[model samples]
Target: MEAQVFQALLVFVYTDTWPEVEQEDEPAMSQHLLVAADRYGLERLKLMCEDKLISHIDSNSVATLVSLAHTSSVPK
Candidate 1:
């Protein structure tokens, strides 16, 4: 996990909430968090990160997002 993502995960663990992230960073942060969430078996956090990713889907991001979705242990 990245330092930023790891910090966010720790915050979520302690407070049951994700720390604020910049709008432009949201998608990338969510992707990292999704993987970390799965690795740590944090199902609810995984879903939350998935939801964040879903909202950001667009032509510019679709290819990378699809690749990540296919390669990672993100739910199908």
Candidate 2:
């Protein structure tokens, strides 16, 4: 993915809305999510939620990503 797309995805995943996701205007939040999901290996889940709203990023796949994101501090 392009750097801009990656950055946009990060913003989308962390923010609550498209407008709140970033100060600069860009493509739709869904596009960012799709790119991010592909770059981050969450394509399957991202596609599942493609037609949904950006606020639905907390679904199963995202939950898994959230868990994985915190796994570094988890005891093995």
Candidate 3:
């Protein structure tokens, strides 16, 4: 996990909220957070990340998002 990703996870763990991340960083942050949340059994966080990511779907990001979905099995 990246430092920012871990830091956001820690923030969420403690405060039930994520730190302020820039708009451009939200997708990647949510992706990493989704994976971390699953690995740690943080179901609500995982679902929130999934929802955030879904809203970010776009032509430029779709392929990567599909790959993440396949690899992480997040929707299932």
Candidate lDDT (C-alpha), each: 0.87, 0.48, 0.86
Query: Every model's Cα RMSD, please?
Result: 1.2, 10.9, 1.3
TM-scores for all candidates: the values are 0.89, 0.31, 0.88
Best to worst by lDDT, what's the order? 1, 3, 2
* Among all candidates shown, the one with the greatest TM-score: 1
Error of 1 at 14 (Å): 0.7
Q: lDDT at 18 for candidate 2?
A: 38
Residue ranges of candidate 3 with Cα displaced over 4 Å: none
**Clashes by residue pair, model 2:** none
Instruction: Tell me the tens digit of each residue's lDDT in model 3 across 1-76.
Output: 8888889999999989766789989998998898899889898898889889889989998898888778775764
Candidate 3 has an lDDT of 0.86
Model 1 regions lying over 4 Å from their true place = none
Q: How far is 35's C-alpha from truth in model 1 (Å)? A: 0.9
lDDT of 2 by residue, 1-76 (tens): 6666666565556763332444233224544555456556654535533544334544555764455335422222
Compute the lDDT of residue 53 as modeled in candidate 3.
Answer: 89
